[model samples]
Target chain A: MSAAPRSASRADPSPVPVIELRGAAFGYGEHAVVTDVTLPVHRGEIVAVLGPNGSGKSTLMKGILGLNEHLAGTVRLFGEPADELRDRARVGYVPQRHTLSSSIRSTAEEIVATGRLPRLGWLGRPKATDRQVVARALELVGLSDRAATEVATLSGGQQRRVLIARALAGQPDVLVMDEPTAGVDVASQHVLADVLARLVARGVTMLIVTHELGALERLLTRIVVVDGGRVTFDGPPRRFAARRRARDHAHDTHRHDSELAAGDTAAVVPHGPADRSGQAHA
Target chain B: MLEILTTDFMQRALIAALLVGLVAPMVGIFLVQRRLSLIGDGMGHVALAGVAIGLVTGLEPVLTALAGAVLAAVAIELLRARGRTNADVALGVIFYGGIAAGVVIISKAPEGTPANLVSYLFGSILTTRTSDVWVFLVLALVIMGTLWVLWPRLFAVANDEEYARAVGLPVLPLNIVLAVLTATTVVVAMRVVGLLLISALMIVPNAAGQLLARSFTSGLRWAVAIGLVSAVGGVFVSYPLDTPSGGTIVVLAVLIYIVTAVSMAVVGRLRQRRHEVAESHEHEHGPECGHEAIPHGDHVDYLHDGHRHAAHQGHYDEHGADEYGALSRDDGPTGQDEEVST
Candidate 1:
């Protein structure tokens, strides 16, 4: 396993990455959707995966969640190989909001309680502590009032919170969410942001996949940009935005040369006339 | 009706009906909730082929039919898992194929075979033997025991299969177990309600229970209650009215379903109106309440209860078609044609 240095410390040798992927390729069937990805997520960091539509951002999240087939390379969770990490309760996953079939007539509390399935012994009923944890999860997501409400009766935003609360009820060390703000109203996004900020303050490791930053931009510790099934940029959010602005400026100045440089590393690096002269001297 | 119970055959028939009534709906509730209600009918068709095979081979028809239904259930599950065809399409193909095979096999048999086949097709509850009653009792006990032990895991799988899988539950085996249980229930039910009317027993009472009950366990109890009432009541009514027992039972079940569905809708509407009035009153007291209420308006106006209007609309359309097919097969053109041919 390649031990990547944490961004917070340059020389620290003991801080293990909570999640590590080395040249990982994930997909379904024979096709690899996300390939050659190397990333490490440490504790107490909120990493946002930003990408265009159909750019394999969701696939990358699924790879981390072990929802998809890992065709090649290694994925480590909590310092162990992903496949060997059998204690799934340590990692929480909040999937993208999809309409649950109406036949499943469970309340928000009941759905949240299912998160404790990994913790409970087979055939064991929910204990008082489990119920309290469920209640606390609901409270964390601002859904305490809707605890007894049927999930189908709740609005989309409320349903999303219920899903998040379900993951929280497991008391996981790492929380991964896919498009948590997509299709959510602005007010609900702000509420999610507030809840996430609290989770960050509590030292929960978060990996979020989203197309747009929206309300979550302020909370992002790092931004990883994926394009064409590969990670194109990995750095702080401000540097990403600055690099993007510089690239756009270069595109406006020299459209033909920018087109020619599309697949090159220089397309990503911020380049202007001054940088070109400095590069020539070097 | 009470005097009819004095006869030996009537006593056996009553026992059979009661056993089926209590147990069939217990399995049926899961099938209906999973939207696999048609599987009962499909298995019934498969059992018909088994009965025919038994008659030609000089074996016990009930035992043969049970074997056939179970094999068909396993086949259906395997095929569905393979995703070769959609569930309904696969069931339809197997169902019609089974019936067609039975017809061919029965047609090749002696003249007396068709008469016996019709009895199995439409059910002859009054002709049930003591041994049949014993078989029904054993089957009911087995079904109930297995379900009791596996209820929580089965419920989890039925409720959300993918989520259950993610939680490391044995979904595939639970599904197969459920299918096997359903097949057993169908075979047991065939002796009382007949192949044509078996699905009505499995679907109507359970769907009605879902409409009336607020929770999963309560819904199951309601279904069993409804099934028992319809079964016992239909037998009593059939004795007095001189009607076919299976047809009467299905009709009673369908009637109960309609009444419960209408009443639940009425109750839901009333509660919705009351809640709206309270919300509007709050809006009048404080303009800020209006802003708080707008999102809820769309939710209640469309969803009302947890039941999604669109999903229910689709379900009703499909259910209506199935009910129509079941009723027609029970006493309509198919039944008349069989009588004429025989």
Candidate 2:
């Protein structure tokens, strides 16, 4: 629904994509997890990567972020080879938030300020501008007041917001989020959705790897589905939903016949209305 | 007591204690943060072998121990950084070998070296030479100067290694630096806090510091304060009580940790009772109240202090955007927050 108006307005957009992957294969060590991926994320586009567990969705994102090794084909960030990208601060990463260590005694502000480390190397300290950026990032995530509070003292959702703020603090051109809404409650998901919506409104580009789509489905411009370690589908969210619905109907008729159906439908499906995922991961 | 504080040896011991107290926790807080709380212990164990090497070869034990610990630290880091199964097993083997080798090697030294080993195992404060104090001072300065340049990066790496690397802050190198710092601290403190018990000085004060401090900045301050008291106080305590300075300092730190823990526990209980009192004070909060009312979920939350409170089943329920209410009362709201959208 949100993609139609944006697509119509993109008649004179940037020529080069923020991230481009061509026939790319990504994995840890010598083993390839995802292969032959052709994807380009442009400015102001929110792309959702969907897949079954261990289906290489994460590996693809990691490959783009230069975490996973690119075994075959090319991966580029901001038109530069992933490995050769000199301006690292151009990309922001929101890793899955772990339980904050209580003993570390880091405040929310301290945690978010670290996002500026790329710009200010180990020896350089955070100046006025850096502090302003950190404060603005905290404000973007609606965590301005929680800045001084110990991260351990924050709620799960608040902790998650702190992580997003940490990413935003970097002032990156593209945000790479790996399951930003995973393991969070509905209300927290909604809050995270609002934060992301605000960010998108500011023209922040995003490439998210998530199984659950309910929280961010409305804002999604396109859906890329990775199955059997390949890009099976790449289209608008509505088309993807429709296609999955038809596939699920065919799958349901044979559900009883196949004893070893790979995915558990309920488990793979996002928890919301029927159209949220329409069916299990394809 | 006053005269003991005046003697050159006593004064030197006190200065050394102060320096040990100051620097041990400075390096220690990061170690504790990395969950490598016992890395200092491992380094300490390894440094003992270096000490034995010095004693047997007739060199300064402190300098030899420093060299030993630094080399072992780098080797352990390189192996651990390689990230394999045997690296872990090798680490354990090395640590075990260090202590056993130290004991075995020290036995081969001159007859009086065995007697001298007592001061190395448990600190003998009066025996802390002038040169040892200068070594401690220089090493302490080096540790502090390094931390000053790398504090934020170190904290970031310690807090989350993957995130730090994602942001491109050289995680492995920082971790290596931390290991080296642990080694340097262990050996520098050996003459005063004994190689055997050096880790206690490194960790216990920081542990105690965390019991009361809620922020990293404050935690560092608290740890240093606790370390100073324990180290300096231990020396003073040993003079009157006739105890080993190392044992006294470790015991003092443990005692401080115990007291802080018990005190915090009691305060938490009191806070629980205080909640009941606040319940009685709770009046109807609506449009008439001056406090700003923010919409929260199914109900309305009144923004007071830093967090929001909503009425739930006739009692005030703490409200959060995610409904995962985290109520820590010490912190206050500093500025305006972006509206949580519906």
Q: Each prediction's interface RMSD? A: 14.5, 6.8
Off by over 4 Å in 1: A8-16, A244-282, B85-90, B107-115, B277-342
CAPRI accuracy category, model 2? acceptable
TM-score, one value per model: 0.77, 0.84
- Writing each residue's lDDT as its tens digit, candidate 1 over A1-282 gives 555665643223545788889999999877999999999888877899999999999999888877778999999988999888878667888878743446635567767777776677566667899889989999888766556656776656667888888888878988988899999867557667877887887888889999999988988888999989999999987788899788799667788676677847654464665466546546
**Candidate whose TM-score is highest:** 2
Q: Write the per-residue lDDT of candidate 2 for residues A1-282, one digit (tens) a residue.
A: 011223523322666778888889999889999888888777888889988888889888778777767899987887788888877768898886663455678888999998887888658999999999999999888766457777876656667889888888888998998888888767567777878998988889888898879788988888888888999988888888899789798777787556445455645556556655655443
Model 2 fnat? Answer: 0.44
What TM value does model 2 have?
0.84
**Which pairs clash (backbone N, Cα, C closer than 3 Å) in model 2?**
none
Q: How far is candidate 2 from the true structure (C-alpha RMSD, Å)?
A: 9.8
Sliding window of 10 residues with minimal summed lDDT for model 1 chain B: B278-287
Per-model DockQ against the true two-chain complex: 0.08, 0.27
Clash tally for model 1: 0
